[model samples]
Structures are given as structure tokens and as C-alpha cells.
Target: MEPTVASRPDPTGLNRRALLQGGIFAGLGALVATAPFFADSPAAAAAAPGGPEPSAARLKLTKFKDPLRIPPVLRPRGQGGHDELTVRLRTADVTLHSELPPVTMWTYEGVYPGPTIETVSGRPLRVAWENHLTGNIPVTAVDFSLATGPSPDPLSNYPGTDGCQEVPGVAGLPPWAAVHLHGMLTGGGNDGWMENLIGPGDVQLSAYPNKQAATTLWYHDHTHHVSRYSVYAGLAGLFISRNAEERALNLPKGEHEVPLILSDRNFGLDASGALTGRSVHKVEMVGAQRLMRPHHGPYTLVNGVVWPYLEVEPRWYRFRIANTANSRIYRLMLLADGRPVPGAFQVIGSDQGLIDKPVAVDGALNLSPGERAEVLVNFGAFRGQALKLVNTFQGVTPGASNQRNDLAEPDVMQFRVADRKPVTRFALPPVISPTFKRVTPEDLPHDHPHRWVVLVGPGSANLPELWEMEEIDPAGITFPSAGIVQVQDAQGAVKTLRRTAMSYDEGRAFTAAHDGVETWKYLNLAAAPHPMHIHLAHFQVLSRENYDVTGFDRVTRGSARPIAFKAASVLEAHELGEKDVIRVGTAGQIVPGPNGTPGELVTVAVRFPVVGRGVHHCHMLEHEQHMMRPLVVSPAAHLHRGGAGGHH
Candidate 1:
């Protein structure tokens, strides 16, 4: 819900009133068109009066259109900019009800777990996104009622391709969104061009700065307009950035180091367990509700499975954990092997990648949306006990009773350590490290070749200005303005237009891929603290801004997301390390790389690479697809790069 609103309608006068009618009440002709603002939650409850019998999770077909597929992209890994990615947007049928969603989703590449992306820092990537839509663009309420009733599970893929240049599991959709690789240090050139979210027949290209501490990251739509709903309907995948520098660490490899991308979803199906289309020819109301676990699902999933199990041997293991939930935090812990056996958690990396020193924690690790953390668990002592990785984050959520009551339910998995251990043993070292590779000020010819971008959100006060500027596009009203902005009250038949910046101050206009170091801050002014994760480079939280109490003595308040964080990575350290995304805490103050030291503020010490560029932006899928800006990273040395799109 980035601040993106129009005072009036686009050249196509589809004002808030029209937008609401289409999204909530379909086929209402004129009566439903009378009111502009959408029906609030109470209204949704009122619309349904008394919901159907409170049943356990069931499968349904929220959308059974087609698949959103894309081409497999392979770019030569390096410390430069963007690699190449070919993304296709199509539609498909999906059956997911059981505590997932009642709404349809238009994903990048079809399937629950979309396609995979791999690149190196500095190697910019070019993704050609082609969108194809069938039903209404934003998927109005009318488009969903097509389902007669609910049915069985195991949803199926769409029918024949119509020769739709198919790409395995991915297809396309109506509403379009550009890809944003959250956390990459690339420039605007490779950044996910969120402003370019198109409809059928539209295409776009973007890049990134793949330079950073080598690690695993992710990519998703940054279209803040439909952020929540879009991602809830499935539109997220992983970004793998490898660096040759850290290979000597001798960390877990092969099956030892595992990447787990976790998400929660519910589907919609018909009474006969069929792929029910969008709203029936006519619709009533369309919106979000808490059917399963209230605001978030009580059931936890590791790599899309409920209480999935994993077998672990008596050795060191690298676990990459990502919290992809729309709004759920996991306080994770490993039920260490019995006291007889030696057991402890070693911290190798964080949201971005491996940390310089591996810290030790007794138990309980936390993970938030769009955040990634890498750690090692030693099972030498409990070579015989049955251990489990669990989430003790009970009260953290509102309605977690369902998952809390079932210990095995909340239990992520189990580990059966091998009876004997010998080869390749690992332990928490006082300081784990990486090969630093940051560029010096001298390396960057221009004294001020750096770029300064901010994450901005236009408040309710800026709707008029936004409309006046005509930045509003043709797509119907997307945001709650259903975003992180002040929810405006609709008076009478007129609706207020207040735009919010999904990821505030996205200075795409200013971050056109640079040739060296870069620094930017995600300044959020909304009430809700968002998890700001970047791709490509692993940046440390340099400093936090202290806020004074407001109202009392004209004061403000201080805030911090993932509040546990102390200091962030340094300039030289992050430059040479391998990291994709960094968790920009809610403090609203983000400092890239190590500390800025004296006389410096909001500066990220980024090093220029010798190859292509990569992308850097928010990982929150929905936030990215809408209006999040793009960034590009270039090299210091003079050179010409062939503007080759991801063609083949």
C-alpha cells in the first residue's frame, strides 16, 4: 500500500466508486455503483450475514484461469549487475482452500513456488516480462462468483496452452506486476521496474546490482497496490547469489546447507472439486477475511508443508530460513538433543548472508516476512535423542491457539543424528568471516557517483497532489487505498483518495545503476512497521534513528523492526561478503554496510563490480509489483554493455 492515489479518475474516469463496485459488488449494474468506498470488514461480515458453518480447512478454487509462466533464466555469475530473467505472466487454475485464501492470485510464473533466479553481485540482469490476461484486469468481485460451491482438494493446472509459449509450471495473468529483487545492491537499471506493472500485451525490462555478501535472496511483485492479496495468492520465489570469495569457509554444502522458502496459502474450489472461475457472471462483495487463523494462519509450514520432518545427522548443517508470510512472525527454536549430548545454535548469516562472526544463542530464533536468516545447529551431544525444530512464538500471534495446542503441529521437523560423526565436523567459531571486496572512493572516478534513495509513503494529505501530477495509471483502484497509509473515510457517495508508498521514497528516477558505492534508507512514516529486505548485497543496519515522544512535548517515538538487532554490517565487510537482502528494522532508520563513522548519515558503502548490474528493492511481493521504484548499478571503468533483453 505505497502512497499512490489520484484525486480524480484516470483519463478513463474509473473513480473510487467505480473501483469499489468492480472489486466488491459485481454485475450490480447501477445500484452497486452508487457507493464508492468498499465495504469495510464489518460490511464484509454483514454481506455474508452469518458465514457458513465453521469448518476445518478445505480446498477451493479462488482462480482457475490459467498459469503464469516464465522462461528459465541463466546468467553468468559475477560481482557486477543484473543477470538475465525471462518472465511471462499468464493465468491458470489453482485449488487451494484449506486455510489459504478465498481470493484469486495473478502470479509471475505459475505454480505455488514460482520460478527460481540466480545471479552474482554486479552482474545486472535483464528480465523481459510479458503479460497476458483473460478475465477483468484487477480481478473484480464479479469474476470470482463463478464457483457454485466448495469441493475436494489437490487443485490442478489449467487446460491446453493454446500453444501459449508455455514455460513449464509458470503461466500469465490479467493484472500485471514487475519483478523486484529485494536486497540486491544493483542500480536502478536492474531494479524491478514496479511502476511498469502492465496488463495483457504489455512488456517491461529491469536490472539490478548483484554485488554484496554472497547468499540467497528472493524476488516478487512490488506492486503495492495489491500487495497483500497478490502475494497471498502466490507470486514469490528465490534469488540465489553466489560469491567465489567465501568458498573457503568450509560451511555445510550439498545436502548440509538447505534453502527453505516458506509460505501460507488457502484455495477455493467448487462443490465438485472443480476449478471454479472468478466471480459468477454477477458478484456481491470481494475482500479479505479471517477464516483460518484470523489475521494470519495458525498452521506453520516449512517449504509449503505442515509440520514437515527432516532427518539430520550428527554434524554441522547450514539452514537458510525465510519468512514469506504476509504478516506472521516465527519465533523458531531447535529442541536440542538431550543434555547428555552437546547442542547449540551457530549464527552464520542473516537476511543477506553470512555474518563476519558466528554468534551462539541458547534457543528461540525469530523470523519475519521477507526476512532470511542462516544458522548452524550442532547435534554432536544428543547423538541418540530425538530432536525437533519448533516455533515457540505462541502469544506473538492473535489466534495461534490452533497451532500451539498441537505440539507436533507447531513442530517444524525432527532430526535423527547419525550414531557416529567423523568427517567434516563443524562448531560455532568465535568469529566466522568473509572475503571483503568493497570499492574505494578512489576506485569510483566520480566523487559523488553514489545514489541516494528513500522509501517514501505519501499520506492522505497528498491525494490531490498525486492526482494533479497524473501519476495514476489506467489500472483500477488497487490500494486502500488499501495500503500502509491513513485509511480515508468516504463521505456520502464520494470516496477519498489517499495514496500510500508501499516502499516509501523509491527514487527510481535517481538510482539509474551507478559505478561504485551506494547508500539509501527506508524511511517509513506509517503506523505499521514493514520488514525492508534488499537483494544482491547483504547490508548491515549501520545506525538507528532515535525518535522523541510526540504530542506530549511535541515528541516522537523510536521504533525498530526485528527489534533484537544491535549493530549492522560495515561498509568494507558488506562489500566483500556475500549477501542478498538485509532486514531494514522498523526503526525507519537504515544504514547500509558497516557504521558510517563520523559526519556520515544514510550512506551504504557499496563496492562497484567488474561485470553487469543487479536489482535492489523490497521483497514483499505485492509491495514490489505496484509502484516500488527500480535501481541500477554500473561499474567505475568506462565501458559499453549491449542492452540485451532476456531473449533466449
Candidate 2:
């Protein structure tokens, strides 16, 4: 039987008495311990030809031993006025598993979470990113048909026809390399265009003003259609912008601050016992043909180490946690002896910068892919106790019902609190970055555009192949894809938008007036949640609305019925702060509407202060490679100029 999307938990069905008695969170440990383990089967081997087979014997649960690896800081190597930094992209062997050999990985400066680029907020940091990798690309297990380019008819078996494949004599092609400063407000050329890739021996120089506020940003490979594979092979790093205001607060500093960059990978060994990256794809038999599906890995790694341990002092320590996983949602919590520690985490900052006030959270902190959280954990009370950083959401792929039990992915990293003070030089502040001004509904202009961004995926339920392109006009207005948009009239009957495919270049997706705040309603039409991210500027979520999904799928397939949209609650505490990436729930997961099951709708207000070109789309690198759309934030003065391609 085909798997159905899990419905949202009914609030009225929850037992308040049991939760108050600590039965809910306490029962989680028992459930994980008693969960069943499934070994590899014959059918599983048939699905992935080169991927790692899921076996019960490969489970490394509770195997925390080695010390956590801290990435080295990449300081500028020039005089005060001008700062110069250079990095080389080369292949390095990294040992992820104790039993397995070191895996050959593509990294920047020969490190997984490559050297951290630390710079001041306003300092000018210019980087010369060099590509030194030669010969065949390290990752081999990929479906070329899923390339970001337009797909050919099913009858044609043309290789390299997809947007990302290599074509003979195509100047400056693979061994391609590019860097995208995620969450950095920079110019268009330095924004890392997927089309502007450099080959081996070529160096791409980017000048970052570091004008944005101090925060934990990241840099990763955004090289054309193969980014999903390049990043999987380890070409990513952390970029931190430090400022004086953040320093005066006296929050954890120096040794007390730790950067926890999280990611997951699957490894396979070759003849010489050398480890190689493995890619997994689900195979489904559609009639007599086979189709490949996208999936997530089984092993989780923190700072390039698999289930590592950290020795910590019994004091307040600040942890900058980043979820670098390709497609996993982690509800992270600090567990002491398999039970949660009350009031352990004090969330002080987020992706953009520090919040107005520190939020004391005692429960799991939900984080999707590409999301970052600056949290303070006071180990002062847990002296000599072993605390485990655990993830509660357990699912291998999208749309699968989440098993709260974490038997398979229980511990992220273990922290052994010291019995004595290692040196208490820093203390937690009552308030952090108190000067942050939140952009509210009242702050937006009355002329803000009410735009709708509909997330589309593969129409077939049997395959995980996503819809490769979005409907965009040459003039930069994205229309809903045919069969995806439905309208209700006065007669109370649903009508579908006329299905028409229009050819548009990669750059033309959306046109937003410069310095103008716009409200965008992101409606997920797919069967799973996507982390929608906007480049160039941060955005504030206005509210959430519920819309019909069961009717949407049917309407997109020619079945139309009346549909009604309902208003949901405001943003949650964690979501109230400024964020560049937001997790949007799919259409079939919410409560059923008059038409049928509805998807969740998130409305966010955004404004681009700088006039330039940039793109905004899903942060899920897998989906972004093929399904993301671009944005042209034109200056107010540029609107009076030419229509298409005016920014250039």
C-alpha cells in the first residue's frame, strides 16, 4: 500500500493530564529503547544499485567517544584597510566511521566544515576562491536525468540534455565551482549564480562588505545542477560576522563558544579500504519502466564527526548550532540520563542576528535544513553529569510519518560536564541585542504587493522526482502552474487556471520594487514540507493560512470542487524573530477544508534595501537545484527602464 501523509495532531485528542505528569516526554526514552530494528531485505538491495544498504548491523546508536572537531578560524592575511583571503577546493580523505576507512571528500582548504571565515561586521573581506580538483567528479552515483535543465520527452533517451549535464565543447564546464554566502547581503556577481561556474585553474574573487549585522552565516557549493552532490562530498564552511555590540554583552566568548555544524552522510569503501561517498535513490516500477527517487542519509555527523563527544565545564556555554543536513528536520533537546533537562537552553540569537530578548526554551528546538540557532546551555547544575544532545524527529525521507522515537538517531553529541570550574570568564546576559527592531504588520507600507508563491513537485505519487520548472513570464511575474491553481466563484464551484507552458530564461522569475515591502503567501502544493529561503534580505512571517490540498491535487489533475481558505494562528516563539529561511508545510497535512485536506500557507513580509539582482527559493538544496525560482529586486529607479533583463 502507498504511504499516506500524516495528519496534524488533533489538539483536543492530546491528554493534558498525562503531559502534566511528565508521561509524554518521559515515555519517549522507553519507546526508543523498545523500537524494532529491520535488517536489509532482498527488495532493498534491488532499489539502490550503488547506494549503501540499510542493515540493522550498521546501526551505531549511542557510540559517542571521540572529541568534537572544532573547525579552525580563517583569518584575513592582509593589512587593515584591505583584507585578503584565499582558499583552495581540493579532495581530502576524512574518516567518518571508526570501523570504515577514511572517505575521499571534496573540501575547501582540506576540511569538511572548512576553515571558519571570521570577520568584523563592516570589514571588507575579499576572498580568492580557487578550484584545484581535476579528473572525474568524486561523486558517481547520480541520475543525470534529474539535472536542473528542462526535461526531454520520455521517449527520448538523450544523456546530457538535462540542464546540468556536461556537453562536449561546452566552454568552462565541470569541475565547476562556486560559493553562495547563505544569508549574506551582497552584490549580484558575488551572490554565486548557479550559471556562473568556474572550471579548474580558475579563481573566482568575491568582495564581501560584511555590511550585514553580526551572525552565523555559511558558505557552500552552489555549483550549477550538481550542488546536491558537491555538498554531499563536503564543500561547505561557516562564515561568522562579529561586531562590538555583541561583544559588550558578555555572553559566552572564546573557549566557551562552540560552533556545531551538523550534517549526515553515508560511506562505502573501495578495494583499498578507502571510503567513498554513497548516494541513495528509491526505485519504483512504473509499468515496465523504472524511476529514481530522492532520499536522505541514515548517519548523522556533527562537525564532520560521527556521534562525537565534547568535554565541557560546569558553566554557561554558548553553542551556535547549524543544521547542515540536506533534508532532515531536527527537534533538538538536551537530554540528561535519557530524560530532558528543564530550562537548559536559552536561545539568544538566530540566522540574521541576536533577538530582542533571550527566550528560555525547555522543550525541543525545531530546526529544518539550513536553519541556525544561537543557544546558551548552562551546565552549571549538571556537574559531573553526562548530557546528550538528541534529535527527536525520526524519518528517513519526506512525507513519511515521523516516528518520535530516536532509537536510530538518538544522540547528536555527548557533553561531559566537568566536576570543577574550568574558568568562569563569561556569564549569560539578561537581554541580548536589545536594539533589534522587528518588522511588524504596521511597519509595512499599504501598497505592499500580495503575492502568492505555490510550491510544486512531481505529479505522480509513486516517484520522488520533482517538477523541474516553475511558471514565470519573461517580464518577471510568476504565475501558478496550470492544474495547480484553483479559484472559487460566486456559484461556489471550483475552476482551474488554464494550463499553459511558457518558456522563460533562468534569471526571470519575480520582480520586486526596491525598498518596497511585499507580503508573500507561500502555499506548498507538494506532499512534503520545504524550507523556503529568500536571498539578499531577511523576512518576517506575518501569519499562516490553511488552504485545500486534496482538492488542489484533484483540480491540478482535472477534478474541480469548491475550496475555502481558513486563517491559522500567528507565528510561534521561535519563528517570531527575523529569519531568511522558513519551513512551509505541504498542502495535504493540515485540517480538511470544505473541499478536502488543506496545506499550510505562510505569509511573510520582505523588503530589499539594496538595489540589485538575487534569487529566492527553497533552501532544500535538492529541490532548489531543479525547482527553485529567481528574484529580480530592481531599484525603484530601474523600473522606468527596460522591461526584461533590466538589472543587467
Error of 1 at 329 (Å): 3.0
Clashes of 2: 3
Q: Model 2, range 1-648, lDDT digits (tens) per residue?
A: 111211322111113343224222221011111111122246633432222222223343335544566765666644468676777776655555444445556777665677677778887778888887665555534233433432322211111122223223322225788888888877777778777887889888888778777799899988766776677778888888889889888877776788899986544434654434332221112232233233345556787776766767888898888888776667777877667787677888887888878787746777788888888888887777778787664232321222222124445777877667545566667768877877778888886676666665454443222222233322431333344455443345543343332112433456777777888767665556778888776787777766655554432442244234554644544576778888887312223344433566688888676555677766676666655656777777677677653645
| TM of each candidate vs. truth | 0.53, 0.75
The candidate maximizing TM-score is 2
Worst-scoring 10-residue span by lDDT in model 1: 462-471
lDDT of 1 by residue, 1-648 (tens): 111233422211123454343331121111111111111245433332112222233322121111111112223323233344455554543322222322344544433344445555445556666665345333321112113331121111111112122222122234666666666655444555445576678776654545555776776665545555455545666666666655667778766766566664332235655534331111111123211111233334454333333445667777777777765555566655322122356666665666777666543455657777777766555554456555554333321223222221344444555556534556456656544333334544465443333333223322101110112242465332332121111221212222322233532222223334554443333222334444334443443342211111101111111112223333322222344433333321222222311111223444434233333444443333332333333443232344432112
Best by lDDT: 2
Which ten residues in a row are the worst by lDDT in model 2?
27-36
Error of 1 at 138 (Å): 11
